[model samples]
Target: MLNIRLASSMVSGVAGELLAAEAQTHHLRSTCSTSVSTLSSLESELESLLSKTHAIDGVTNQISSLALDTRILSLNATIEAAHAGEAGAGFAVVANAVRDLSRETAKATSTIFDHLQAVLSAVDRVQKVHEQLREQMLELDRESGVLAVRVKEQGEIVSTAVRFVDEAIDAATTPCAQAQNAPPASDTYALAPADDDYALAPADDDYGLAPVGDDYGLAPVDDDYGLAPVDEDDPYALASDEADEPPDSESMDDPYALEAV
Candidate 1:
């Protein structure tokens, strides 16, 4: 019984540990799932940014074209101002200022193009990195899910083992409990109901003799033998009955009784 109890305790402890492990695995799976989702979202945002960057690249090209058109218009104005001579000196000064402004605009637009290209390149690299991270996170999520399932399976196995141990403990302890609670063998037998035949039988050793006034199919007793007489038709009873017969009358008178007479 003690051994069974010890086994039960051990099984229960193992089952508890299995359950705890299952819970931890479940938590890890959840974390992995969430991380996968977050990475996926980040990848999607990166994709959106990449798309917007492409659109910005188109806009930047249009700005560069506008700067080239402005520079051309400034050059045409400067040529017209040179044709006007001294009367267009003030106009020539304004034209030179406009041409300088156009040149600066062109330089600024070129710088912006270079920076935008770098940004686009960086965005592409970032998108690729994000894709790799997303893939890794997804893989981790799947592995964690499998691990959680295995842990749960182990928990179930532990539960089954615990149940088996509990049943064994019950089986082992039941007999002892019954033995402790039940009556002793002697008392149990003594308290058993008596047979009706034995209960009705006479206490004395009357053999098969019927009472003097009774006629309940029982045989009558012989006066000398004090037992029922043997039946003539019963072959088995004749020899035993003769052997058990009382002695003759002469044998009944003792030597002491003859002396007295």
Candidate 2:
């Protein structure tokens, strides 16, 4: 019984520990799932930013094409001014300014395009890194989920063990409890009857032998030592006043009483 009780306690403790571990495992699984989701969102945003950055390439290319067209138009204007000679000098100066402006615009567009390319590259790297991290988080989440399931199963087993131990403890101690609460042997003896038809002797008063004024039936000792006188009121007395009387005259006539007189 003691061993059973101890086992019950140990099993209960194990169940408690298992429950705590199961809760922790579930929490870890949830955390991993959330992290995976956040990483996925971040990766998606990075991808979107990378696509937008690439889209800017088309705008940069159009600006570069417009700058080249402007330079070509400025060259045509300079040629026309040359055909006009001294009368087109101011026009040639304007054309020269326009050509320089177009050159500067093209340089600026090239610089912007290079910066956009660098941004796109950086975004792509970030997206790839996030994707990898998301995959790792997904793996961690799956493992955590499996661990949580195992922990939960173990907890259930421990709980079952604890319940079984408790039932065993109860079964082990039930008889003992009844024994402790039971009546004593002496009480059983008191309630039982004697084996034979026997009974206890009555008290002295029940035998008609009670002392009267401290003198039982015994008389005082004297000379001749005669029989003790009986109490006339006693129901068991054998002597009476008639035994001391002489025979009547009628009895003298009878042969048996006269003895052949």
Candidate 3:
């Protein structure tokens, strides 16, 4: 019985019980540390994804702004075209409106394109991270790799598109100096020649106005604004007094009177 009692005391001793409890506590602490580390890593990945989403949103806003500017340019083009008239001659004369609108639109587009290029570059780098992390996720295998590849290629494509747009803006900005501010042309189609010592003679005693200058055939003009002839006593006297007067409707084409022949 004393041996049995001694054996029980040894088994239930403070040293052994305490040692076992301490080992269990250490194990729990290790497990908790691993859990904390995993959670921190997951939090970091989530933050990266959030940052990427925000970047995409910013780029989308930029694109939307560019589109709005382009729409304004389009409307301006249509409005200016409607007003250009026959005098515009060709597209060159009207090119100012087009060039101005295009330039403003190009400015907006270039800004968007530049920002987009930056975004694509950043995304490209992040895409690498997205791939490597995705591979280590311990989830789906083939789908994750394929998705990563597609995302990376899409970023590259977006970069190319942005570069193309920027180039287009630069090309459109080329200016022509002479086209915008050219002087109006000299008149080519002047009417009649000039004369000296021409006098406008008096008409009837009652009417002071006389038609004078050539055989446009005059009459005793009575009204302030000219009407036409009444019954004339003689056509010869009318012709002499008609000098300086515009040709009448009847003889307007007579080359001899105009000295054209």
Candidate 4:
């Protein structure tokens, strides 16, 4: 039977340790999943970016070469038309017009190509930046979530500890209050506000409170044992009857017994 009890205790301890370790592992896995997803997305984006960049370079170069060739051909045609005699005179103007048109078109194409390349470069840079920012955002969000979970867990643990401390304190103080040997928790409890205008009575004898004499000029006390306002003429004070008294009980019966009759 002893061995069984020991085995059960060991098993419970091991199970608790395993459960804690598993929770830690689960949290780690959650972080890893976010990281892995980010990395995967980044890798795929980079691959697409590399392919697009290669294609853009090749297409831009080819278009540039084509424009250059067209300009050269237009120039040669004008030269040939100029070398011919009067019979080619009419053709010469046409050829010159063709050359001018070619130059204009080539300039337009080159300008367009430059602007297009610039736009493409800008887009690529922006996309790369966006991808990086997205990865960072994902990482931050995941981290924040993990931190929030940890904070919540800590708060719960702290709340549980406080509750346990309160219960234990209440249990330890039970005996004291029962035998009237010490002040009760109720004494420590804040006095409730009276619904009526009448003053609230102090704790009574049943609550282990002492009897008040005529000098019981009740004063307001706070949780920190600080005094608030009070009426000096008020008949209620906290004086007890156990203190020194005169020989005859009837002599002290008057509310103003101590005062000159």
Between prediction 2 and prediction 4, the one with superior lDDT is 2
Q: Which residues of candidate 2, in runs, are more than 4 Å off?
A: 187-261
User: After superposition, which runs of candidate 1 have C-alpha atoms over 4 Å from their true positions?
Assistant: 187-261
Local accuracy of candidate 4 as per-residue lDDT tens digits, 1-261: 355445545555554555565476567657766776776777677668767766866776676677677668767776777788777777778777766766676676677667767766776776678678766766776775676566556656655655555566567668767878745456433443333234354433222222332234343333232221122343333223332332244433545534321
| Residue pairs in clash, model 1 | none
Q: Model 2: what TM-score?
A: 0.68
What's model 1's lDDT at 160? 92
Cα displacement (Å) at residue 135, model 3:
28
What is the lDDT of every predicted structure here? 0.69, 0.73, 0.51, 0.57
Predict model 1's lDDT versus the native.
0.69
lDDT by residue for model 3 over 3-109, one digit each (tens)? 54454455345335544554555555455455556655765776676577567657656765765675576566566656776543464445555556656666766
Residue 190, candidate 4: C-alpha displacement in angstroms: 38
Q: Each prediction's TM-score against the native?
A: 0.67, 0.68, 0.29, 0.41
Q: Which regions in candidate 4 have their CA more than 4 angstroms from the true location?
A: 1-66, 169-261
> Which prediction has the highest lDDT against the true structure?
2
- The window of 10 residues in a row where model 1 has the poorest summed lDDT is 252-261
- Per-residue CA lDDT of model 1 for 1-261, tens digit only, reads 788788779878988988888788778878878887887788788788888878887887888788778778878888888898888888878877877887887788788889889988998898888888878877887887888788788889888988998888788779989999999664322322233233333343334334433434334433445432244333223222243545344434533211111
